[model samples]
Target chain A: MNIVVCLKQILDPLAPAREFRVDNEKKEAVRGAASLVTNIFCENAIETALQTKEKLGAAKITALTFGAADAEDSLRKALAMKADAATHVMNDGATNPDPLAVAQVLTAAIQKLGAFDLVLTGRESGDWGVGQTGALLAELLNTPYVGFVDSIESADGKLKLKRQTDNGFELVEATPPLVVSITNDEHNVPRIPKTRDVMMSVRTPITKFTLEDLGVDVATIRAGGDYYAVADLSIPVKDVQCEFVTGDSLEQKVEQLAQRILEVTRAL
Target chain B: MNNVIICLFASAGFDRATQGVAGAGRRLADALGGQLHAIMLGAFTATDEAALAAIADHVSVATELADYQPETCLAALTQLCQPLAPRAVLLSNDTYSQELAPRLAFRLGGSAVADGVELISHSEHLQVKRAVYGGKAVATIALKRNPAVVWLRARAFEPAAPRDVTANVEPAALTLTTNSATRIVERKSESAGEARLEDAQIIVSGGRGLGGPEPFEDLKALAATINAQVAASRAACDAGWCPPTWQVGQTGKKVAPGLYLAVAISGASQHLAGMSDSKVVAAINTDADAPIFKHCRFGIVEDYKKVVPLLREKLAAARQ
Candidate 1:
């Protein structure tokens, strides 16, 4: 079996809320001091693939990412965790392409890689959280897609998955050449790499591809080429002010807080 | 092309989120000065049909669907919309709809934006404002194609109240292939019928500061007093302290309720992403500098262990 896991490097989502800012003029996020890291859910996807590889015994896993050159760091992390190979599709087009363009480039990359039994991605990117690439990629590649997949069991090209929904979990089945967007769960926590593997993985060579190499024109896949447009961006203003429960003791504070909440909401 | 279609996904029946989608769709239709239509796929009872008819001008039920697979849904909705050429298609930001919205848009040669909290009409364009960088900022977006498809955030608008007028029921022309590549084999309830976080009027969420899963027992006790839904942050969920279903953060369900009470949470931006839309937010944490304090409407700087039980007692007493 062969599996391809899509990875994304996003600004640390765990950063303090105050550090995040949007450049309204540039229509982009202001880079903060928090360093870039592989999106948490993408790591979960990698872990999911690794778990499947362990269960299958004879399987190769490839970590693929489409982003600026810095994305190689994410690929290396996947390698450190024992992915067989790393492929980087450099983003030479617009700085921030929409999900459609991203999916198109991914489809091109997957086709270039020849054959794969499965393709996996995070449920959504931590930055935009659009949750569209996997399904759209499935459409472009003309494959079946299952999103919000939490667990998977595969045998003989047939895969059974447990997917998360608002109501609860639903069991679904699909064949090979299927796309699945994985979500983070206790079972898929990414493993930490040993120091030796981290050193060796850093030395491993990475395969690189450009948009042109994938036969995709940069202009057609850039930001403004898409049908959707971001007209404006602004920081959301909060009108409600924090009314602190002033009290001397913890008991008093709880009483004050409860009374205040009930007074404001009148739910009682 | 001016009609607005609201794709309804009826679970056991027409839940609150479904009604909210209907209301939102009606709002968009009214803005465009167009008629509102409904398209329901999968199993819907007679009561569901009657309820839908009371809210929409026309209701189209695709009776052939076995389940809510995206391919079958896209095929059926395409057949319905291609002839109608509706100006917009609205859906609730539930799991199925989020997955279906973009693919449906792609098939229709239209555009999609997910998790929109507000919709406004400017001239001939529909402006949708959605959260970005978690909930720290808002992006007002415009779709450059017809039949703009969107998934409105749950609880963002009031659910359409049932009216006395009945709608014209029309069976949709469904062109479907039995050779669907994907199929739902079975469904099991991960969490039994508990208070749903998306539909609850009040939400009480815990974070890493709670120490362990045992403390959630007290949080549940507190929730019982206020009839609030219980949730947790990624930290607690990742720590194996609680089920991920109870996780409320950028990765979890985004909730906007009448009141949100944060206990022991440090207010990571990702956690705020899911709850900042809440109308009135309050936090109780040991640390005075927890990030959630800045975003909330009230704060109680104290240990939640002592605070939760007392608050519960006070709330129970106050209500009496």
Candidate 2:
């Protein structure tokens, strides 16, 4: 079995603050010192794919990404964590493209890579958290797919899938060559990297795929693209002013904090 | 029974809002001339069943020895759905539902749509409404077939209140003829948030006018005194002061809490799209012309730093 983990690098939700300098420039996020992959949900996808590879014995793991130049880090991050190989589809300055086009672009890369038994991605990316790319990709491919996976079981060449919902959980099953998406919550805590492994993984060969390589259609990618539109990005202005909490004592400060939380809870 | 099987995800442990979302689904089902059939796959406990059955009509539960394994539950649903195929499926747009809605749709051979806001049915086909393009446009989705699974973003729609119907509970076991290769080596929950942003009923949000993230503390203090969640405009969230979950806008959580207290949040269309529908909005900002002031039922054109602290002081006094 061959497994592919689809990844999208995003502006870290907690990225450091940067001023938006131009009409086209997206609002800069605070990097917060460390650049992380998209939403944590993708980690679950990678974890599930790697686990399946281990079980299959003769399976290989392929890590794939499509984003701006900075997003190469996401591919590197996937490598450091343990993807057998990594590919980054570079579209300069396309840090945030329409998600549908992004998925379509990635699917083109998948087509180039040829056959795989399974494909996986996180439920949503963090920056936008639209959660549309995976389902949309499955639609484009017309493949059997499942997401919000809690667990997957296979036996006798049959597969079972469990999906997480709001009130409780749900279950579904499908055959091979299926696409699955998982959110971080459904699975357990992700793996931590050994220092030696992280260093080596980042250094490993990460193939770079581009518009020419993945065959991005001019109609679908540029302005007046089939799926999305580009608009100006604006940074919101800021003003900070506040009166200090004037608690007479430390105990009083604690009481003030509790009172504040209680007040917020009670406003309902 | 024209049942709409509203499935939810039961993770390793229980979430406080699961019951609330279930209760809301029950109300929605009842209003639509349908019954809410809640389903669960987990290591069942007495407490779990009790909470689940409270909001569902027929609770089909499959208990597992392991923590709600994905493969086991998927296999179980494949079997269970065959016996209990419903008109439509509703799940929260949380991580689990987002994943399952499509997979379940694939297994049942039905059309699946995610992040639906409204479910309108005509002639056995359902027309689902969902936000597209990051809240830029509302798309009406036509369900391709029967039993189409539609996942609604949690907190987007209001869960109806519970009715007086008695919930029926049954024990189910998945005929898991397969074993999954993925084993959870370790599972960790995100840092426990003091406030469940999805569940909060009262929100106090700041905006670019707050100057810096520093003044958000005043809004936080004010909100805490009133028992409210802290929210932000896109500018604030994008500024990296508040998390995205705390953003109330078209692209963010559409909140209708009883009272939404706005401190310095300018209501942009994108931002207003989320909060404009709130039950009652009260905004305190220095700019009277601020867009948020127009949508708000009560508007106070004053410095938030002054008014927020005063409001906090009043609430604190009233509680005592």
Candidate 3:
């Protein structure tokens, strides 16, 4: 069995999230990058893949992603997590798509690769949480997909999925050659790479694919700017400082904090 | 006075903390001397028959969904609202409600406000108060009149409890159609944080400054220590430091917590626009001139690096 995961290298938010050029038309903070380190959702995807592979005992897990050259760092991280192989698509393409385009590109990539038993993606991207990619990808693949997933257990050649839906929780089961998006938050945190394993990940052989290689037109990809928008982004000009209420001493500070809480909540 | 319509996610099985809104809408309608109509779609969840009806003057349910589809749900709501011509169409901002709200107003060609908190000054320009700037400040929004529609973030308001002796069950018979473009073929669940941000009493948010995903550990530690939930600004989520589900801004989640703490965040107007209405906001930033300071009742002009760790330590020590 073969499982494929879709990922994108984003700007690390910790670095100078602010970068501007003479051409102001393109001044987005580092494209939501810092989230690359086994993001909660991605880790869940990897975990799901690993679990399914374990169930099959001889299954293979492949990491697939597209992004800047630095995105290779994330690919290496995936290798450290014990994925059988990795694929990085580094080329000029839409940094963000209308989710549909993303699905299309991912679908095209899947077709290019040999058929797989399962295709996995994070329930939602760290940057844009439309929860669209997985659903759209599944729609394009004409396969079944599950979302808001916290855990997965396999048996009898069937994968059982649990969903954290709007109201609460529900469960679904599906066969192989299906699409499953992993959910994240608190339930399942991604495992950190050990120092020894981390060093070895960089040495793993990684396959590189481009839009041309995938036999897909880059024009078909939608620009991130068009799919959604950040209309007015700016720092507020106002300044509202703390109104200290005589918390001169430690005990006094606690008391004053309590008093302020009352004032803020209008309990006073 | 105008008629009231409490558009519910009863079909979606009630989302987030929509129970609060259902309860609150009943109270608001009672206060305004209007008929409180509880619109339950799909099947009823509440076991007590009388308890459900006490909140509203009347109860309506739509069922046999054919299947759970968004377009089908929206079309059902449009048909329901067309004949009623309600003064305000209230909705809960769930995964489906968020999509349903704008379309409901659009299908009716009426103006609507999403993520509304309180119906402040509803005469003429039905103004509402919402949280913004990471729950630091509150802003007033005036809804365009006639048939005003509003979508409140989940848990924004409390559901009305039934005050009457019993609920009068009225089943709605309607042919609901759906768009074939989408379907829910699979769903899976993962272990999640303590409480959904919308339901938490305390929220801790991080901005672009935390540096990386690992630092979220510190924030998460602080939240665990204080029994608080974690949230993030659009900038942080946009930069990939955090997931969009945790984002707090105009384009993200709107939270009105009892206490909102923002670390390393330079309060961008867009981020603040979604959280400004938080009851008490505390901002910790290195930049004293950061816009977040203006809305905070407690400003710690120090590096979040030192502040977050120290805060975690202090909170832990105090708890111990």
Give the number of the best model, judged by lDDT: 1
lDDT of 3 by residue, A1-268 (tens): 8889776554332233133111124423333333444434676778667765666677888888766677787788888888888887765655544454566667887887789877888754433333456655665676655555666666676766665554355655667667767765344555677899888998899988776777655665535422223222233334555654344554454444444443443441
Interface RMSD of 3: 8.3
Model 2, residue A246: C-alpha shift (Å): 28
Better of 2 and 3 by DockQ: 3
Interface RMSD of each: 1.8, 10.3, 8.3
RMSD of each: 2.1, 10.6, 10.0
| lDDT by residue (tens digit), candidate 3, B1-320 | 45567776554444436566677667666656676676776666666334567666777877655345555676788888777777667767665554455446645755555466777533555566544322323345455544556777666675564464655778876776754433445543332534556766778899888878888888999788777788888667767776657877654566777788888888875576557767678877778778777778875666667666656665666566
The global Cα lDDT (0 to 1) of model 1 is 0.83
Please tell me which predicted candidate would have the highest DockQ against the true structure.
Answer: 1
Candidate 1, residue A259: lDDT: 80
Angstrom error of the Cα, residue B130, model 3: value is 13
Error of 1 at A259 (Å): 2.2
- What fraction of the true Cα-Cα contacts (under 8 Å, chains A to B) does candidate 1 also have? 0.77
C-alpha lDDT values of all predictions: 0.83, 0.62, 0.63
Best-to-worst ranking by lDDT = 1, 3, 2
- Give candidate 1's root-mean-square deviation (CA, Å): 2.1
Instruction: Give candidate 3's TM-score.
Output: 0.58
How much is the lDDT of residue B71 in candidate 3?
A: 50
Off by over 4 Å in 1: A248-252, B43-51, B161-164
